[model samples]
Target: MYDEMSQLKNLLELIEEPSDINLDPEEKKAAQVERLFNMLFEEHEEHAKIVADQLNKSVEEIRSLPYSEFRKVANDLGVADSLLFKIPRLNRPRTFMSPKDKISSKLFEGVLPPGTNKAEIAMENKKSTKELSAFVSVDFDMLPNIHSSQEITAYDREVHDAIVSLYVDGENEYITNQMVYRTMTGDPTAKLTDKNRTEIDNSIRKCSMTRISIESSPQEAAVYGMQTMKYEGNLLYTKVVTGVQSGHINEWIYIMEQPILYRYATSKGQLSRTDINLLNTPVNKNAETLMLQGYLLRRIEAMKHPKYNKSYNILYDTIFKHLKIEAATSGALRKKHSKLRDTIKKILDDWIEKGFIVGYKNNSDKGKSKSLSIIIK
Candidate 1:
């Protein structure tokens, strides 16, 4: 039973690490049974004992039952197997990119400095100067024109027909006129209507199906071709713009899932993963950096609002306040303070090139030290 409990915990960890499990039908069935065992024997041990006691069975007997027999027992105990299976296992949130592999890949792609680590690359990418430099330095090779100018083949006609058919099939009376008008006059408000919006959304979804195929073809071709052209074609831009617009439609979803406010309140710090995700998303990275800077500045302002005297005193008071809210009787406040300080230091160092904050040497009556301050300008 103890061994089963340990295996169950290990399975939960695996599920949490790779949240989206893709398994064969037989494997999925086995995974479901494993999930049930984990939920009952590992996560809800005390509850499992209570259920076993009510059923006049020993915990060991319950653990030793076959999957089919366990299902029967669960049903008799009025426990929903489906509900238990659906419960998400808590896991450490993964960073947006793997530190080693992703950083090395970016360096080879010429998007990062040759010798930089993942943490350093992440920090550099957040800098405005580094971004501008990359934008200017990186050269995008163009795709070759494969078709001959004089020869008109059946394949050529078929490709053109396919592209045109895709466009025609996607059209709607509602947005077509507005889209035409917008094309003519360069005014987006010409297409501002519920019917037009719905039509545009439908068109975009249909277009996306083709775009994915086209994008995948280039990647497949790269395996064979020595000098692959990383083309910024019309299709690619259209897909990118559509994706950005779709993100706007789902803005509320992202905002609700944002870890900034929650992490600030609960952990008393921001994680690097949070910042990296924010930057990687289609939303404006510069604006996000400024927003983060503003949040930190606000915290500092609150601390020095003429009510709190010494900086250390402010820190102590803030820690105590959070401790009260958390009902933390242990040394949790001290642990949280350490995390907060580390988070602040990381942010200050990374966002320095954005001109949102600055770090300076602090040499007072004591030895030399370093301190961070908000760039007020």
Candidate 2:
């Protein structure tokens, strides 16, 4: 059997850090080309075919062009050029363009000049002023095997996702407080309301302490790139978000630095190797974010015990309250029993449509009625 840890590490380093200082210029150039090709392979699958058709060159021949040689051709070709410049600099999240090879070194190695912080140094040194990218590559393989049942309120998940969106965007360092408030509460343009700010503070504190278990062996999971990212493992590295206007509300945001692995985020933003966003998006009649969350929580509860597995049917009311829905919204949202029941039933219908759950035996009210069951693939 192959050793996954060492192989994945080597594969990432060779492909990720192509411009490593240790490599000679020729070797560095070759590595850079390979990494660029890999990025193209992931994002722009048709690049090879496009170039091949235009130049009347075989895909293999076009691929054979080294970094230096391809630059000239890419400039002339434009977006379909598939060159380093054609892709957004944001795409080159991991590869630091600073004088220092790594983003960490750039921030940490030098003595700070007077008034600057890490976020300030990052803005001056990094590729983008608005977004901060993760230093480590995003690993997707072991993410699916994580079995976590600890329920969290939808608000916390949103807060987590907003921060995670930053992480996935490669803003793994100091995220702006405004970014969090905007992304989490779904009021992107406006400043954080005092009520929302308190919600943020509470959620972050909870996120720091919460830990989901890895059902598999720790060593095995780590070797497979799960990164030992238990919430309780290392507290989120939070700092005052720098780079804000003096009049604006400034607060802290967090990221897990190097050596600490990031766990899978619950948000739909986390993409897999094939570019699939695995998070389940439930449809709500209201179409609002909060309403959509209610559907999601209901669906999750439904998964825990389908009537097919056990004798008892999972009650809509049981799931409704389990989701921690506030009483105020419940009265307004759940006014008509049939209406709310139909809406919740639509969740089961959608699951069945997606083949996530099954209607193995729906004998109607008089006959043998069973809950909609989960279909385990």
Among residues 3 or more apart in sequence or in different chains, the pairs in candidate 2 whose N, CA or C atoms overlap within 3 Å are: 132-170, 132-171, 133-170, 133-171, 134-170
Clashing pairs in 1: none
Per-residue lDDT of 203-272 in model 1, one digit per residue for the tens? 3322222211111133333433623322221221221100011111110000111111122222312212
Report how far off residue 155 is in candidate 2 (Å). Answer: 3.6
Estimate, for each residue in 39-116, the C-alpha lDDT of model 2 and write its tens digit. 544543476577678888876676567545455444434432323111111211221111112222221222222121
The TM-score leader among the candidates is 2
Q: How close is every model to the real structure, measured as TM-score?
A: 0.21, 0.35
Candidate No. with top lDDT: 2
lDDT of 1 at 73: 65
Error of 2 at 279 (Å): 11
lDDT of 1 at 27: 62
- In model 2, the Cα lDDT at residue 355 comes to 59
